[model samples]
Target: MAGYSARVRGDIGRWQQAGLIDASTADLLRRDVEVNARQSLSFGSILAMMAALLFGAAILIFVAANWEAIPRLARVAALFAVILGGYVGGAVLKTRDHAAIGEALWIVAAAAFGGSIALIGQMYHLSGDEASALVTWGAGTALAAVALRSNPLTVAAVGIADAWLFLKGFDYYSRSDFPHVFVVMAIVLFVLSFWTRSQPARHLIILSLLFYLVLLATDQATLPVAIPLVVASVVLFAAGVLVPERVDRIVRLGGRLPLHALLGFLTGLAVIQFELADEHTYNSGFTLASVVALAGIVAAIVFAGRESRGLRWLAYLGFAFELATIYVVTLQSMLDTAGFFLAAAVLLGILAIVIIRVEKRMKDPATGGATA
Candidate 1:
């Protein structure tokens, strides 16, 4: 929000200089923005948030260290007091026009809620697993995020959910039904992002889905998991790059959906390349994978690169990894390796030409954004 405020101010100045608006009107707009920007995030507020997180951690650690010394009822009272104080104090601060600071306190409360769940479980000697406890904590935080409309709390919930997913499903071959619930968590968080407007949470959920898919592909020798990953990634990227208007109509992420979709495409291609490396037929399999990976990266640049710096960077990273892996696998074949680099150079040169042309046209007002 602070960044948004700055951009708005910059644009206002530009508009004023361009004579798009009168000086008086510009001053009025600046005043309005300045007044509203107080509620947005600032450097000090971020520090306060971090301080709240540290304070919560310190309290939890102190209590745990003296758990046996303190009376059980007093311990329970202290935990509840911590949780209530966080939320209530946050509300008070928000009402006093400290929105970011209040939200930071909400995060402290959320963390305390999770810690209390674990501590109470220990105190009662309850019979339940860590996965369940983490899930419950995440769900509670999510509910609080909804009730409070908190972006920070929503992001925190997504983090907790990812921790649970990784803890329970790091071994994809395990017989853990809990890990399979990641899809539900992803869907819920994705939908919840719209309500809380926590764009980071949306990004995290997408990454979580991709991480889970990669794990799902791991050790599933019976199924061709890489194929599905590649297929899905391509479809998603195409939907965003080709039919962006339609995709954005539903996803409403401006240009971010395509950026992340391209990332997913790269991850899928990387998975394919590595899965093929397992077969020992590195020449054929890796070459095929490299070709596909190169194509995907090029398509990203040609299609969505102009709008997504993230997509462009991801493509660059994918190209580097693809080249390195193929080089490693084709070490025995000097002729093949030389041929591969020469071909890659040619392709990249062509891509560079295309990019140069696109930039030229983008700079030319007559051509505008028609390069797409």
Candidate 2:
């Protein structure tokens, strides 16, 4: 049997060498031959998912059964324990073996169980100051993510806590108190990014960026065009000068939420300053600089096309913003209806062309590789 198999393999190898098949086609065939090499689920993952479902259901049943009997403090403690236990168990299992999906499942189960615990607690009482509880839970979840190297559950737990903080902070937004939750979140996510032991770490970092941007936006900072430009400029400069030049880190840390927020805030400011009736008559220096800044941003987009999807999206957004700025400037200043309509037609045509190009790129194998 072995000899016959070797003979067959030798025949195929000879056929490939004799120009009977192209390399790409041959490679595809080889891949097809080994298609089942992919692992669908290991025993560990199956066990973990089952455990997660069971634990989740058990927690639900426990709460439903003891709806009124459980003390408020005890319920809170129970919730915290479930989350903590899930996190600990998941982390321990993952640390022992890194490539198990069960680790992620366990962490998820923990969070689900934790949620039930929280709801149960809520039924009896919410603390006079719930921020402490939120912070503690968020911090614990983050720690578990680190220990277990599970990204999905870590993100899920962090996001839940962040959402709670956002709502809580909004109650005090009038007093200019933005949730400092991002500071903790940033530290936790930064640590996770460095670990990079799991695919979920990237997700956690992305979520962290998102939350940080939300924090920045909701904060009391006067979001004029200058602020975001300053932020981008400063971060880019500092990242260049201070941080070691790791491309992935630089892109994640530099080009993520802050850049997006800066673009959004600046674009918004542009709309506010130029698009309105009375605001159109601004000084020439600022307007020229704004145009230059916007143009620079577009140029950066083109340059960064291969580097970051966020930047590519920003480019589209920046162009739309520029057009909006122009429309407002014209409406407020000249009010030439025919000219405006013509400009709109031209802009739409440009946008259509750009979209077609983008769609083609998306379909292309080159630009739309693994990252895309």
Candidate 3:
């Protein structure tokens, strides 16, 4: 009864407030509302499940019916229509305060439609050939997702486009051919982040990072183009550290760790080492040392700005470990011999002391944010 009367009681309360219902009638209405609300909730759940099943069946039917004759354009058109219809239905129902069932139905219906369209394309040998078709589908799906404010569809579109680009690069096109596409994809991800209100922007920022990675680290034409990449990242990091009002909010909103900039810096180091590997005897060791030193300096700067002594300690510890590991590796490379664990132990001892001193200086306990 309590469940059933919820909506009715709410309406009755509003009516009472508006002087449309007297006290006795309001009480009666409230009781009936409780009973009705419970029943409706159950009914809504059942209806949503049924709609989901029907949606699946509709997709199956569409695939079976269009197996032989459907063209790519027509299939895509049908897919857009289905997604549009689902979103429209959801919006209308949600306005009536039927949010849960409406959202469920909308999601399932749109998914069924999108899946059916993709399947139809597959059956007709429409996918994987023309870049234009794939691009068109991706753009259309993304637009529909934005218009409908549907996270699932938006995420799906993002995945599809990314996978498409990856496939093209790895299997069909040369690695040199993808920097432009990756840049465009990054832009798309950032734009999508702006449109989403409820979803976390972290996912979008990560997606943007991935695209940037592909452009700078994967595509042969742009790979090792570190001058521009480092300059951009350094500027971003510097601003994120020095400018309080501008940088803090943006980085926090972007939900990225200042530490992850290490990835780009490491990549740049790797590129330099690769280019100089043949010309130097201690090439790998040199690279490792350079990275350790640079990382230490950057980490110090970041820790001071953010007041995160733990990260600073971690950075120093990482550098120590890398130095010890590289020393052992260099010896093995040159002399074809390996040292025992004693050397590693000694390095750890020194590292521990340095960390202790740093922690004391910062007035922070040597704990917290410690990874095993």
**Against the true structure, whose lDDT is highest?**
1
Predicted structure 1: lDDT: 0.80
* TM-scores for every predicted model: 0.82, 0.60, 0.59
lDDT tens digits, residues 25-144, model 1? 999999999987874566887898899899889999999999999999999999999889888989899889888778888988998999999999999999887878998999999999
Q: What's the lDDT for all of these models?
A: 0.80, 0.56, 0.57
RMSD of 2: 8.9
Model 1 per-residue lDDT at 121: 98
The residue-by-residue lDDT of candidate 2 on 259-327, one tens digit each, is 443454444445334424344365464465457656656555444454456556766777676667666
Off by over 4 Å in 1: 1-40, 171-178, 221-223, 278-283, 332-372
- Give me the displacement of residue 324 in model 3, in angstroms: 7.7
Return the candidate ranking by lDDT, descending: 1, 3, 2
Better of 1 and 3 by TM-score: 1
Better of 2 and 3 by lDDT: 3
Give lDDT tens digits, candidate 3, residues 194-310: 574423334554545545565445456433475455555556555645664676465444323444444344445445444454445744545653665466455644445245544
Record all residue pairs in model 1 with backbone atoms less than 3 Å apart, i.e. clashing.
none
Candidate 3 residues lying further than 4 Å off, grouped into runs, are 1-86, 89-114, 122-134, 150-153, 172-176, 198-224, 248-260, 274-278, 282-329, 334-372
> Candidate 2, after superposition: displacement of residue 57 in Å?
8.6
**Which ten contiguous residues of candidate 1 have the minimum total lDDT?**
363-372
